[model samples]
Target: MATSPTTTGPRAPAGPGKDDRLTPRGKLALSLLCAAQFIIALDFSILNVALPVLGDDLHMRQADLQWAVTAFALPSGGFLLLFGRIADLFGRRRLFIAGLVLFTLASVLATAAWGLAPFLIARALQGLGAAAVVPTGMSLLTTTFPEGPQRNKALAVSGTILSLGYTVGMLLGGVMTDQLGWRSTMALLAAAGGIVAIAAPALLTDSRPTERPKLDIPGAVTVTGGLLCVIYALSTAADQGFGGLDVIATLVVGVLLLAAFVVVELRVAQPLVSLQMLRRPTVAFGNLGGLTTFSMMSSVIFLLTLYLQDVLGLSAFETSLVFAVQGAVLVGTGTAASRIVAALGARTTLVAGLTVQSVFTAALLFLSGDDDVWLAVTALALASVGHMSAVVSYGINATSGLPDNAQGLATGLVTSAQQLGITIGIPVLSAFAASRVGSLERAGEDARTALLGGTRTGVGVDAALVLVSVLLIGFGLRRADRR
Candidate 1:
């Protein structure tokens, strides 16, 4: 075979063009990709709700139950950049289809799991599959749609669908877990994954790059390993104190490995992530903004889940309904983000989004068990809208004006930041809540009040982080920086 390896851009028949209208084929392709996003959203929600049931069935201890969530999270977050760059080297469509097959198969295994180990293995496989799909899908979107109205519209549809999927999943997960049993949740993912996997081949085409850069094995190992260690450390700290030997050891290892990754990137010719790319204002600021928004979103969900179910004495389904409000608002705002970006430019839109999120997150500080839980619901709704706005805007702003070759890496950075944010947010913010729990208990407060104090403390921390992102936007969101 000839070695005219190509970077995976769009292999769309229309190619990049002047007009933004999609052919019928394009719409079908977009729908398939968007469906994958929906599956991911649904998968996330269903698993969380089903964990208790799984733990009981498998006879696993409560301590080990976190693995159900962590197993999926670890590889998904850690291997993103690796698979993303691989998508460029091999082929986005090829990797994507392969990933989907793995996801679907893993879902089957998970549903049929007879033991804890098998289920954990299945979750890991599914996470690896997600690692491949998320970045590749975004990369394909950027390539398939011509920038301007076409790309903007496609992204809008994707963002809206993404939020809608989360809401739908939360509601569906509860219903499925309650009525049909937790097994139904895994079955649902398999069905969704199978449908998308089947459509993928017929709808999407792969672009092969001209030159296949040598894989940066060192860079890949160090970075992926580093991220894994980091997330593990935070998780350990959440359960065991941060001062524990395991937590400190993992933190040191993670930092050292990440530093080594930096060194390897500088030395290697075909680095996993380009050093130059890191310096771009859009890349740096965009990823930061994405991380901030996503972490807070995850953190808020973690805090609220405990508060709503435990403190407010709400059912799992009712808690899901409250969160459904946020997800619903995100769908609307996500749909409208394109016009907002058009009018204000991506930078301005991003700043506006960050600001909106800050305001709403801060408002949650006032919430208490005495106050109506609607206060939390309303704040989260507004915050979700703002979060989606920031998500879409930051995506456009980051990927804009990039050479085709770099789009894969760009998307990887965005996706990795998102996963990393979510992974860290829950553990770190949960630790914050846990930290306050002991203190409040010692103060002679009732269990509900103490738990309430801890949850609010976590919410306050999320609010502060959002404000920090606003400061970053102020400094970085400018016309000159977009380049």
Candidate 2:
């Protein structure tokens, strides 16, 4: 086993006593960490509203617009595990600050872009920075807050703020795209990242592993390559078809590289990800549960956004408002999550939350060309509440029992699950829904009706995914009880 960081580095301070609720230092830590997360969240949602506007402004097609997102997502998703391990070996604070600076600089470059290449390059740079920041910031949070209710409360706040950022980004992206230009989204992120950067050094202390493990060169190389290939494959599959030779080949290579990565990790003295860590029940199930929750939640957002704008002909601003309400629901539920988790246990909470999300997603099947809107809107809001609650509970489960040095890996695992899920889910589910639409259209349905029907189909599939998670958790909990 790897050595603990008791004497070697600035490990997280002991948990705050009840008497010290939101002390000055605690507030500062929370503020700083949350701020980083808030900015990252902003970047993710901001682009969704702006993609069309960007395609027009840059004189690019939908293909190029997808690239703009893929450029960012590839590095961010691909390099997360590697960067998380690096943060553990080197210093979490060091990587966190560095990533922030890099992200801000790229945002500036993106904001000033005049054409496709510069914009795509800048977005990729931002992703590289994000790959470092997400896990390291999360590591800092786990270490700073301690592993109990205090940490749960802090994570709830982070999840709430993060969900709020997505809401804000949607509204902001629409307003900015309408009033100024799509570039304004990047400008907004740059401004937010700057403020967080200034506050971070003052609030965060450096924490590194006690005995630095030699970088697992093969593990890092193979895993990074594998993830990059996988993300590329997913993006390609989403854009093109799975039948495309390119997508199939890329996906095959990704699977092979990942297999190689696992073998290397097992053989090596210092592994990028400790396979032993993956054996933890909470860690394993937390990520699987979280993956289903996030993927399904994000798929709902993607399909609904398209249905609202493309099918129902709602303006981007109006669509943003609808999602804004959902965001509020998420924030509210997140606020109450700590109490719920304490009372119910993370496992129980996870099951309940997943069940709620599944039910609401299934409710979307009630939506049709009738454009009642209430069915879609109500279900979305309720689903957001459950989704955010799951996020908090999963964060607690994944990191709760992890040691200080392993915090980076724990957080990285969950974060990777989220990114990969979003990346994979939107495409897979969307394709299924699109197929349904095609079938209906071939059978003589109107375009609007086909779109509405397609979105409903996607929502149904999303519900199925969440329901599967519920069953998985229920089964696992039953096994644990038997033991």
* TM-scores, all models, native as reference: 0.95, 0.95
Give the lowest summed-lDDT range of ten residues in model 2.
1-10
lDDT (10s digit) by residue, model 2, range 1-483: 232544243323444443224557877888888888888878877888778879998889877678877898899999999998898889888999999999999999999998888999999999999999989988887777667767788888987887677667778888888898888889988988888888888888887665877999999999999999988888877667788899899999999999999999899998998999887777888888888887888789889888888887888777877887898788789889888888898888888888999999999888766675777789999888788878888888888767777888899997888777766777788778878888999999998888888898898888988998889877875675576
Clashing pairs in 2: none
Question: Model 1 segments beyond 4 Å from truth?
Answer: 1-20, 479-483
Residue 388 accuracy (lDDT) in model 2: 82
Question: What does the lDDT come to for candidate 1?
Answer: 0.83
Best by TM-score: 2
What tens digits encode model 1's per-residue C-alpha lDDT throughout 1-483? 111234434433443543546778888889999999788767666777777887899999988988888888888899999999998888889999999999999999999999999999999999999999989988888888766767776777886776567567767877898899888999989998999999898888886577888999999999999999998888667788688898899999999999999999999988998988888788889889888887788788878888888888998878878877777687778778888877787888788888888888878778778745889898889888788888888788778778666778899998887778877888888888898998999999999999999988988888888888888766875645654
Whole-model lDDT per candidate:
0.83, 0.83
- Give the distance in Å from residue 312's predicted Cα in candidate 2 to where it truly belongs: 2.6
Residue 374 of model 1 has an lDDT of 86
Find the 10 residues in a row with the least total lDDT in model 1.
1-10
